[model samples]
Target chain A: MTVKINTAEQAASLIDKYDTFLFDCDGVIWVGNELLPSVKETIELLQSKNKKLIFVSNNSTKSRIEYIEKLLKLNINNIKLEQIINSAYSTAIYINEVLKLNKDKKIWVLGQNGITSELQNFGYETLTLDDIKDKELTMENINNLIDLNVGCVVVGLDFQLTYLKLCITLQYLLNKDIPFIATNIDSTFPFKNTKLPGAGSVVEIASFSSNRKPDAICGKPNPGMMDSILSHHKLNKDKTIMVGDRLNTDMKFGSVNDIDTLLVLTGIELESTVSNGHPDVTYYADKLGDLYALGSK
Target chain B: MTVKINTAEQAASLIDKYDTFLFDCDGVIWVGNELLPSVKETIELLQSKNKKLIFVSNNSTKSRIEYIEKLLKLNINNIKLEQIINSAYSTAIYINEVLKLNKDKKIWVLGQNGITSELQNFGYETLTLDDIKDKELTMENINNLIDLNVGCVVVGLDFQLTYLKLCITLQYLLNKDIPFIATNIDSTFPFKNTKLPGAGSVVEIASFSSNRKPDAICGKPNPGMMDSILSHHKLNKDKTIMVGDRLNTDMKFGSVNDIDTLLVLTGIELESTVSNGHPDVTYYADKLGDLYALGSK
Candidate 1:
């Protein structure tokens, strides 16, 4: 079906007609610790309309608990903990489901405490850099660890990296031919006011060293994450729209899921940049306040 | 020009008449310190015939002094310290003669102690990894250290690899668009009892990371190294033959330098494996003793 809209006013009316609202946190809500001026107002207005709102972010560094605490501190009202979808949480769910289906296997995690803790919580024996710190990092160590015993490798962000860790992980991956699952593909992270290597760097290095690309990426704007978001909200493609600042990740999510994306220029991505990228973004707004103005009419 | 030989005996007779002998150590003399039998006897026989000999290895890890010491310890010949030619020495000479021809620009090395020492001996100011260990390994560090101020990056073997070192070195090389001179492309090194990542691994990673391959390879099979060997020994390609086990590295040396290569099956590469490889071997010998048989005939 065609997107039934004639004006910015019609667009606003159509957005309000949906009971479910999905919002991207980074560009739309705030950039870093600073909150966008109209983000709270937009969320509160959606809540007043009895719309079920979900805050989704591709950033996997922080847990949902951390996000909820930050959101509450920002004075955004009428939001529940369950309404937050994060790459970390989705990654946890994926690991849990895979383990349930497979039944007998250990998972080796190449991430920080959050991923390890989540895997451990799911009753799967999780291995992290800390676990292998005492062991010599070598091909032999990898061969001993990987051979037909371990199930899969889950890659995430590890700030304190070493050649030994990378070498061992790469050798194990290449030798055993194990499947790799990454949390997300954000190449760099905004850390301490500087862009630093993130999980994507590890993924890129591992892929290069092993000569094998990742088997699966569990975060947005991958179809698996979008499917989980849609299924959890009981939303249909025609009834939903993706709203985000970044064109590649957010706009891509909408286009891939067959939902329209409203590109907001106030965040990491600009309208001019997304204009040429696909799937093409449906609309562009200067700010989140402009989106609120649509519903006002 | 046509490698005129009607039989193996004719090939043996031509090898016997050659007065100056050039030998490649890796996949020729020994592979990771397991000596090829008859290598000692062949060298002794060549010495008895008053033939000038040079034991050249593309391995940049050890200096000539170290190679001479190792060869002496292995009981491999009546050879002088100057008879051993290593890639580190060749790299130093290249930096001094080619890269630092202006005699003003300082050369910074991203390699082992041997390379730095060689460069210093050649009257070039060399900065070792120790000089930049404390600096943040970023593109900025590379820019700061290696702008138009630096001449070239001489890549060799470094055991203690850090991301910062790799990042800075790569950034500097890419930023300045400077020529990179690699010692060799051996992917792995046979360590004491296990295999370790070699210079080629670092080169491959840095090349992939920066999206730029090395500008020049100063080591083995390259015409520069082979030419150096030929000039130092005053050898005739028509009469001389390169007897080494590895086809790609050793045999390529002969082809690039217009000499003949006698493939020996006692070391790293097998004849069956390299049948389709470059510089199709002029002769195949199971061991170095087979070459002595040629000389004897």
Candidate 2:
């Protein structure tokens, strides 16, 4: 049964039970640049109680440091750069740490500067759309002369996606030995009030063409995104709670990893949409501000 | 049983059986621009016997007229524009004759000039990437205000594909009432010794993003591409043969529609590839030129 937070006592009991709080940024804390009302105070209250606050986002467009800068700009204080974990950061971690790829193997990225930069920071050579600018480039030209050095294809939210990039990605992925990795398999990226094609949409082209599935999807709900945080901090799953707005990514992520999930109604999901079939989301609140009841008492 | 035509007597007897020949251009007729040697002589010999010949291609990159021009340039005589039925041509026919879409309802095309031109020829209002060139275009602007007048979204081989085109395609397709159409689902467009991302790749992105499947695929192996030819001609199914190199598209198209199929080794398929599980192909030859044995007798 999902515990509904109706009063200060219930809220306080729930909040006090967890030593660490994992927050999904886009919907729970703020939607777009505007901060959800009282979210600042709610987070600060959790911080005052000495609870560990970590912001986990599937938005691979921005790096973790950039997210920290945005958070500080929004007046969200007491947040460290280490406290944020974006998909881009986790993807690099999954590749370098989990996959244990060799330093010599390069990655062909079909994403923005954020993911590319994160991979580069891990001391791996990366190639982007800029690498294949030859006007005379064709399939035959590259067919005989494939850069076999490229061992992985990393796909993320790319606005500058092109046909040539997809061709190159397919060529690499055709070799089953060379892994195909995606930051997230989100069909659409909801921004403001609308949705655009996300990383999954771009990756689907190569996947459909080559008849291959992504070897690893390093994002929320995958559990690989939580690797860095789990290693750095010691937290019990029983006491830890994940708070987010989206049911698929955030709620599923928490449920899949055995952490208690708190669903908020500030974003992608609605109260009417939740049902008995939903994966275990332990609690539901109107907004993060409702958690402020813990400090009120 | 698929008869292996290794001898001239078997080849001649098989060729004499079909009154109407439907050819898949890529593998059987020619690989790329270069026509397979003896294919020209074989086609001329078929013409001398007064057999009706039709060049059916799923390559929507060129119009029927353009295909005729290419054929004439290669010195293949006696083929007219109407004798060539391309996916683009049939897609237009399917929309006009089958769908019977209202003339006022404009179509949003995510393909090349070939399909757009064909739609325009049918007196339908067509919009393409060139139509949405306003510098201020964004997802937000198209969010609340959608072009609801769009009755269908046609996806095909587009070399100049862009992200905005995909966004618009998804926006229209989300309506559910609006139809999603594809020229072909051929994974890759085989061109000049290389395979490039084809129409299927572009459609996969929109299909994945929208969580929708194509309402109609107007290409070979789908039966819609042969609809126009079937409607116009009164040929017997037993006397009509689909000659092509690939077992999947070409042979399947014939088998699905109850027409005889001939598999050639000049393109995608080899003798080793065919098995009992595949759709029935009536005959197999080394190349299109091998059919010349029929005339030699």
How would you encode candidate 1's per-residue C-alpha lDDT over B1-297 as one tens digit per residue?
Answer: 223243557645755777666677766787667777667777777788777777778778777887877788888756786677788877766655555544466665767887888778877776655775555655444444434566667776676655556655654565545667776666665643444556666666555545566766667777656655555556677777777777778777877777777777777765556555544576666676655645555
In terms of TM-score, how similar is model 2 to the real structure?
A: 0.86
lDDT of model 2 at position B237: 81
Highest lDDT scorer: 2
lDDT of each: 0.67, 0.81
lDDT of 2 by residue, A1-297 (tens): 776677888888887899999999888888878999788888888888999998988889977888888888999987887788788877888888878889899998989899988899899999876875554565456574357799888988888776767777777887889988888888897655667888789878878888888887878887777664565465677878999998888999899888899999898787866644355678888888888844465
Give one digit per residue, the lDDT tens place, for model 1 in A142-239: 44534355677877666555556665566457654567778777665553333445566666666655667676676778775776566556677776
Q: Give the root-mean-square deviation of each candidate in angstroms.
A: 5.4, 3.7
TM-score of chain B of each: 0.81, 0.88
Q: Provide TM-scores for the models.
A: 0.75, 0.86
When only the first chain is scored, the TM-scores of the models are 0.83, 0.89
Q: Give candidate 1's error at residue B54 in angstroms.
A: 5.6
